[model samples]
Target: MFGSLPLGILQLWHRKFRLLTATLGIAFAVILVFMQMELKEALYASAVRYHEALGYDLIMLSPKTPHIVAARGFPRNRLYQAQGIKGVSSVSPIYLGQAIWRHPSEPLNRRSIFVLGFDPDDRGFEKLLSPTVLQRLRLPYQVSYDRLARPEFGPIGQMIDEGMTVRNQVNDSEFTVAGLHAIGSGFAIEGSIFTSDLNFQRMFPERSASVIEFGLIHLDPGAAVEGVRREILDALPKDIRVLTRKEFAQLEIDHWSKATPTGVVFGFGVVMGLFVGAIIVYQILYSDVQDHLQEYATLLAMGYPHRYLKVIVLQEALVLAILGFLPGLVLSVELFRLTAESAHLPLEMSLNNALTVFALTLGMCVFSGLLTLRRLRSVDPAEVF
Candidate 1:
């Protein structure tokens, strides 16, 4: 075992450039896998959890159909009904819509935005924010714009900060930006305005059929959410969907995780990257094994156990894993930053995610080398001669 150390080192030193290329190829694949998975996770999280940052304990939405609040919506009366449920502390009715904004004075470019309708005094409206934000958000005729919408508004924070009004070309006459919000880092409900539920209806005259887009629920202290959820679901009309806040979040999680094209495409990228990395590592090590067969045969002829040669192969795998993992980890971090900045998605790379990728990379190398050991089993001393 010890004798093979110098031999392995010498072989690596002599063939450093070729070996480096293969190692980098595997590392690059590892980086791609990390980027794909983390981007997918970031997109889903940004889509679903942006509101969770508001810190609401329960969320209610239209039961007949499902949609990400940021993407699609439905009209409903359940917003008020949720307020009336037992063990319910309060409720806030939200009207969601889309519109365009431009600086009252600018290049005069019309920009599109997402619009949220809410109440200033509702108790549930305050659950997701501090009194400071609530006060800021309640400024009369004001709407709060998210990060993504800031540009269309003309300048990110200040444009919305100074205040601007939005016209419901379709519904209400005119509305304004109440304030700007930072619900979570990276990406938000951008290019949008907030308005009173009344004003929302004014703009959406056709909305007599749907009172509020959704309702936010706050339970009385110590209330059982699951029991209340069941009670609400059973009591409500079939068209209304009722779920605990946790259930609602989980439902969104499951929906995007399993149903979206983005998730599946990224998942395929991860699997393919892993397979590609494994192949690269296997082929590189296979080449190295072929070159060293004579040395290995000499050792076997000298009474060295076959198991000892196996240890050398395992050593090479471990060396590659360590060398590759360090750079792969760095690559993953850089990728996360670039994606967050460029994609405008919240791609947070936790230590666990990097660690998981590192572990997987190590496993792939070891398994690849181990399986390719079949080459050693067939090497004959006579062939080497």
Candidate 2:
């Protein structure tokens, strides 16, 4: 196997231009697959950013709430009832809504931004906001702008960072930008704001404080989370749905991946990339096999077993897989960084993703080589003679 490996590589190296072209083809496919997978993952990750940010043992939402951005208001009393549960430490009411944010500089231009309203004293957003930012949020009509929001939001984040007093109009109600936070924009929402529950109600006067969008339940130390969650479910009315943190995050992921067209489109892209890659690899391998047919037949005439030639082709495939995957991986990582910075989406290249793409590339090349095996097997010594 070791002896045949070098022979396979040398044969490919002898035709440097073909080797370069084949490697580039495989690399292009790898980049396509990587981008599609990363975008799909970013869709799910960004969709659940709010869910994962909150500090909660369990969460409660109205059954009618389709997603976090479109959360429906439920009675605040449901959270009060859950607070009475044995293992429950506390419950905080959260409000979610959308309001037209008039651009700070451009008065006529308005854009919809997601607003998250909760008590500054509550632990619900302890993980998401700093104590300083939370304190500022307590001030009436003071809001925190998302630093990762799109540039169209009119540099509120930049002004805040520069310690300038930034105020913006939301639904025609003036609000101060007290601070900045880093919750990124998702596909559905361009930007987000964090404000106290009082300010939230003030912006949307029709939305009563008694009706809340989410209830975050924190469990006591050493308390059984599942047990308390079950008790809360039993105590709450059918209108409210209870879910653990993991379940809540999964809910958002499932909605985007299964219910929406984003996942399907990216998935189809991955398959197409693989198909194109396979065809390129097959052509390379088939052409190489045809070019070397007489040599293969001469080996057979010299009593070289069929297994020997099979090993050479397989080794060649393995070589191509590795050579192609390396450049693809590097380019993909750089592209992910550029996309993340420019788009402000959570596009991370995880280890699992890298390994998965590598595996797929290897499989694609080997399968192509196997398809060329039929031609390899038919190389008769008599015909060559």
What local distance difference test score does each model get? 0.67, 0.90
Query: Which candidate achieves the best TM-score against the true structure?
Result: 2
Q: In candidate 2, how many Å is residue 266 off?
A: 2.2
Q: Compute each candidate's TM-score over C-alphas.
A: 0.85, 0.95
lDDT per residue (tens digit) for residues 79-118 in model 1: 5666677877877667777665555546356655566677
Q: For this target, which candidate reaches the highest lDDT against the unseen true structure? A: 2
The Cα error of candidate 1 at residue 219, in Å, is 2.0
What is the lDDT for 170 in model 1? Answer: 25
